[model samples]
Target: MTWEEIAKAKKASVDDAIPSEWRLEKNPTANKVRNVGEYLDETLPARENSITSCTVTELAGKISRGELSAIEVTKAFCHRAALTHQLTTCCSEIFFERAYKKAEELDEYFKKNGKTVGPLHGVPISLKDQVNLEGIDSAIGYVSLVNKPKNKDEVSNIAKILENAGAVFYVKTTTPMAMMSGCTSSNIYGYTYNSYNRLLSSGGSSGGEGALIGARGSPLGFGTDIGGSIREPSCFHGLYGLRGCSNRLPYCNVTNSFAHAPVLASVIGPMAWDLDDLKLVTKLIIDSEPWMDDPKVPPIPWREVTDYPKKLCFAFVSDDGAARPHPPIERALQMCKDALVAQGHEVIDWEPPVSFIECRDLGASIYGADGYKEIADECAKSGEPIVREVMVLAGNGTDLPIGCSHVHEHWEQNKLRYEYQQKVDKYWKSTAQQTSTGRPVDAIITPLWETCSFKCEDIDMFSSAYSSTFNILDYAAVTTPVTTADKTLDSKDETYTPISDHDRAIHEYYDPELFHGTPVGLQVVTPRYEEERAIYLSGKLRDALSERR
Candidate 1:
C-alpha cells in the first residue's frame, strides 16, 4: 500500500476502536470552533464533565475512599478522550476496551481486599506515542511503524511503575514524524490542533499530549523532551510540565528517534493540570527506585523540600538576545516579577556570562550529528515525506543536514557542550554576591517561547532559543502558566527596531487579533539534577501569581 493508504487505514482503525456512541456526531472544522476545550466542557454530559475535570489527586482520593469506582472513572475519560481525538487528532492510539479491563480489575481488587490497589487506583493516564505498551504501537508518527505493535517484553519501565501505582492507560497521543518537530504533525495523524485554540499549533513533539490534557481529556500524562517538547506544549496549554534532568525519570523501553544519542540526551517527565498533581506523579515515579530496573536512571530518592527559605531570590531573563519575546510574553514576565516582589521575594535581572545563542546552536549540531539519518531511513520504509514543520532540522525543510563526518568531530561538539555547562554553572554560583540572601539565585525565570503559540504552518519562523538552552545546560526545568494573550493589554510594538533578520521575522509575525486568548507561560530553571527544587519554585510562583490576581 502507498503511504497515504497506510495512513488512512491506521486512522480508520483508531476511529473504529472508539465505540460508536462515544464518537462526535460531527467533527468541527477550524473555522467553526477555535476552542475545542471549551466546546467539550459545554457539550459533555455532566457526569463525564465532572469526572474529567477532577485532578489526578482528587480522582485517586475519591477512588481510594470508594466514593468513585475505577471502572466509572475509566469510562468517563475514555468517552471524553474519544471525542477529543475526533476534534483535535490528538490521539495516535485508542484502546478503550483494554482500559476498561484494567479498570474492572482495579475495582474488583478494591471490593475483595477492602482497600484500593494503589495511590492511582482507577485514575486514567495518557501516554505520548513514544511510550511502549504491549499490543500497541509507539509509532512516534511514522506510518512505517503503524502495523507493528509492541510485545509484552517491550513495555516501558515508566509505564510499569505507573501501572503498579494503579494507573489506567486508555490512549497514546500523536507526534511529528520520528518525534522531530516543534509542532505536532505527521503523514499518519495530520496536525494535532491546539485544544485551547484550534487554529494554532499544539507545540510538539509532545503536542498531542498537550492537546489532550489541555482539553481535559486526561487529568495528567507523560511527555518526553529532548529540547523543549515537554515545556513548549505545556506553555501553550497553560499546563505545568516538568523537563527533568537526563534519566532522572526512566526512559527504558521508550521508543525514540535517537535512542542512543550520547551527546545530548532527552528526558521524560509529567504534564498535569495542577501543580500538586505534577509533584505527586514526579515523586511517585522517583520513589519507585526506577534505577534498579533502568540502570541509566540515577538512584536519587525523592527529596521532600519543606525547609526552603522564606525569602527566595529569582533571576529573570527578559530576552535571550537571539529573538525578542512577543508582547504577551513581555507582559507575562513583568506580571511574574511583580507578583514575586509583592510576596517579599527578590527578583533580579539575570545576565549569564554564557549566551543562549551559543547553547542553542551547539544543541542543533549535536541533534543533527547523524544528519537525521534515522528519520530519513524510517520515512523511506513507507515513503512518507518528512512533515513540513520538521524540515528546519534538515536544511530549510528541503535538503538533508550535513552530518559530522568523523567520530572526533562529534566529540568536539560534546566537549563544547561541557564547557558551556561549566561556564553557566560558575556564573550561577557567582550570583551569591548579588542577592540579599547570600546564596545563588534559587531559579531563573524566562519565556518558554517568544510567542504564546503560532499558526500551525508558521512554526519554522520561530527559534528555540529560550527553552533549548536549558536542555543543553542539562538543568532541571518546569513550565508555569502565567496568563493569556490579551489584544487590548498586549498591543504590537510600533516603535521597536529589528535586531536581526530572524528577530525581524518573529517581530513582524505578531498580530494581536490572531493570538488573542492563547496561553502564555514562562519556565523556571534550577541546576542539574534539581527537579525537586525547580518544581517547588514553580509552585511558589504559581501561588504568588494567583494571590496577585
Candidate 2:
C-alpha cells in the first residue's frame, strides 16, 4: 500500500474509537485560543468539566470517599481528551470505551467489596505511543506497525503495574518516528501542536503526552527519556517530568527505537499536573517491587522522608559552554535561583564536571548504536520519508550499524561514557567542600532548553548536554516549570553575543513574541538512583519557589 494510504488508515482507526456523542461539535484548531483548559471548562458539560479538572491526588481522594465514581472520572477524562485531540492532534490512538469499561468494573468492585481498587483506583492515566497497551497498537509513529497488537510479554511492566494498581488507561499519545526528534511529528499521525500555544512546538518524543496534560486532558501521563524526551516536553508544557537512573522504573516490554541499547538504556518516568501526583505515582510503582517481574528493575523501594534542612546548597547551570540558553530560559534559571536564595538556600554557579559538548556529542553517537539501521529499516518498511524535524538529525543514514570494522570505536564509546560518569560522580561528591550544610549539594538546577518554544523544524543546532548528561551520569532528575516566556520581560538583548555557532543559530530563534506565555522550566538533578530523595527535594524547592505558583 502507498504511504499515504497507510497513514490515512491509521488515523481512521484512531478516530473510530471516539464516540460520536463525545466528538467536538466544532474544531477549535482553526482559531486562536490561548488556553485549552479554560476552553474545555467553558465548553464541556459541568459534570465532565469538574471531573477533568481534578488533580490525581484530589481525584483519588474523591473516589475513595465515594464522592465520585470511577466511571464518572474515566468518562470525564475521555471526553476532555477527545476535545484536546481535536484541537491539537495530540493523540495517536484512543481507547475510551475500554477505559470506561474498566471504570465500571472498579465501581462494581467498590460497591461489592466496599474498598477502592488501589491507590490510583479511578485515575485516568495516559501513555506515549512507545508504551504498549495490550490489544492495541503502540506503533511509536511507524505506519508499517499500525494495527499490530503488542504481545503479552512485550507490554511494559510499568503499564501492567499501573493497571494492576487500579489506573485506567484511555489513550496513547503521539511520538516522533523512532522517538528521536526534539519535536513530535511523523507521516502517520502528523505533528502534535503545543496545547497552550498553537504555533509553537509541544516538544518531542513525549510531546503528545505533554500537550495532553498541559491542556488538562489528563492529569497524569507517562513518557520515556534517553536524552531529553520526557523533560523537554514537560518544561515546554508546564508539567512535572521525572527521569530516574536506569531501571529505577521498569524498562521491560516497551517498544523501543532499536532492539538493544544496553549501553545507554532509556528510562520510563511520569509527567503530571503537579509534584504530588509525580511523587504518588513513583511511590506506587516502587512499592510494587517491579524487580520481580523485570530483573532489569533495581529492587529499591521508595524512601519516604519528611524532614529536610531549611538551608541547602544548589548548583545553577545556565549553559554547558556549548549552547547557552536564550533570554527566557536564563530568566527562568534566575527566577529559580532567586526563589531558593530568598528561602535561605545557597545557590552558586557551577562549572560542569566534564565538557558538556564532548559528553553530549558522545551521547548522540551512542544513539546511533545501530547506525540508524533499525529506524532506517522501519522507515523503509513503509516508504515513509523521514519527517523534516528529525530527517537531518537522525535518519539521513550516515552511519552504519555495528560491524567488524566499527567494533573498536563502538567499544571506545562505552569506555568514554563510563569515564564521563565517574568524572561527574566525583565532581558531585566534591561539592561537600563548597557547601555550608557539609554535604554534597542537594541538587543542581539547569536549563532544559535554550528557549521556551520554537516553530516546527526551527531548530538547526541541538545539544542535550543539560539533561542528557545526567542520563550519561545515571542521575535522577525532575523538571519543574518556573515561569513563562513573557514578551514584556524576557526580551532579547541587542548587545548579546552567541557563545558558539550552534548557540547563535538557536539564539536567533528567540522571539519573545513567538514564545510569549510558553512555559519555562529547569531541571532539578540528584545523584544516581536517588529517585525518592530527588522527588522529595524537588517538591520542596518547587513549593519554596514563588514563581512556580
Candidate 3:
C-alpha cells in the first residue's frame, strides 16, 4: 500500500474500535467543546459520573471489599472515556469491550478466592502510545510505525508489572509527531485539545494522558519524560506528575525518538488526578521489584521516610531570572508561599547555584545529537510529512536534524554537568546557616512554566528552562496544581520590563481573558533519587493548600 493508504487504513482501524452509540452527531472541531467533564455530566448517567469521580484509592477499597465490583467501575470509566475521546481527541487506541471482559474475569477471581489479585485489581490504567503492547501498534505519532505491532516477548516491563498488579489496559493516548513537540498534534491522529478549554493546547509529549486524566477518563496513567514531557502536561491540566531519575523505573522496550542517544536518559513515571493516587501507583510499581527483570532499574525497594521536621524551613522562587511568568503562575507561587507560612513553616528566597539556561542548552544538544535525521528517516519510511508543531520546534523552523559530530565535546559536556551538580549540592548544604531549625531547606517550590497555557505551536521552543532544568540536574520533582487563572484578580501588569527577546515576546502575548480559568501549578523538587522526599513534601503542600479552602 502507498503511504497515504497506510495512514488512512490506520486511522480507520481506530475509528472502527469506537462503539456506534458513542459517536457524536457532529464532529468536534477546535472551538466546539469547552469542558469535557461538564459535557459528560450533562450527557451521561449520574451513577456513571459518580463512579468516574472516585479516586484510585477509594475505588480500590470498594472493589476489594466486594461492595463494588470491578466490572461496574471499569464499565463506568469505559463509557465516560468514550465520550471524552469524542470531545477531546485524547485517545489513539480504544478497546472497551475487551476491557469489560477483563474486568469480569477479575470479579470471578475475587468471588472464587475471596481476595484481590493485587492492589490495583480491576482498575483500568491508560498508557502513552509509545509503550509496547503485544499485538498492538505503538505508532507514537509516526505513520511508518502504524501497522507493525510488538510481539508478546517484546512488551515493556512496566506493562507486565501493572498487569500482574491487576491493571486492565484498555486504551493508549495520543502524542505529537516523534514525541518532539510541547503541544499534541501529528499526521496520524491529528490534534488533542486541552480538556478545559478548546482554544488552548494540551501540553505534550505526555499531553494526551494529561487530557484523559483531566477529563476524569483515567484515574491513573503512565507517561515518559526526557525533558518536561511528564511535568508540563500535568501542570497545564492540574494533576500530579513525577519525573523520576534515570534508571529508577522500568523503561525497556519502549519506542523513543533516538535509538541510543546517551547524553540525557528518559525516565518513565505516573500521572494521577490526586497526590494520594500518585503515591499509591508509584509505591505499587516500586514494590513489584522491577529490578529483577530490567537491568536499567535500580534494585531499590519502596522506602517510607517519616521524618519531616515539625517546623520545616522552605525556600521558593516564583520567577526564574530568565523569563517573567504569566500572572496566574505568579499568583500560584504566592498562594503556595502564603499557605506554607500559615502552616508554621518558614519560607525563604532561593536561586539555584547552577545556571538553568546553560544546563538546558546542554540538554538540547543531547536531544539533537542525531537530531532530525532520525525523525526524517522515520517519516521517509512512510513518506509522511512532519506536522507544523514538530517543525516549529526544529530550531530553524524546518525539519533538519542538528549535527552533534564531536565525540569529545559530548564527553566534556558530561563533565560540566557533574560540576554543576556538585556546586548545587554544596549550596543546598550551606542553607542551614540561615535556617532557625538548623536543618537544610526541605524542598524548593518553583513555577512549572512561564505561562499557564499556550496556543498550539505558538510557544517558544527554548521556554523549558523552568521545567527542563530539573531533568538536566537529574533531580526528582513532582508537580501539583495550586489555583486557576482568574480574570478579575490575575489581570495583566503593564509595569513589567522584558528580561530578554524571548521574554519580551512572551510578556507581549499576555491576555487575562484568554487564559482565565486555566489551571496554574508548581513543582516541589528534591535532590537526585529522592522520590520519597518529593512525594512527602508534595503531600504536605497539598494539605497546606487544602486548609486555605
Between prediction 2 and prediction 3, which has the larger TM-score?
3
Which candidate do you rate higher for lDDT, 2 or 3? 3
The C-alpha lDDT values of all candidates are: 0.91, 0.84, 0.85
lDDT of 2: 0.84
Model 2 misplaced regions, further than 4 Å: 29-31, 395-405, 547-549
TM-score of 2: 0.96
Clashes of each: 1, 0, 1
Which consecutive 10 residues in model 3 have the weakest lDDT in total?
396-405
Off by over 4 Å in 1: 402-404
Q: After superposition, how far is residue 388 of candidate 2 from its true place, in Å?
A: 2.8
Residue 494 local lDDT, model 3: 91
Model 1 poorest ten-residue lDDT run: 397-406
lDDT of 3 by residue, 380-430 (tens): 888988787777766766657646557887777778778878888898889
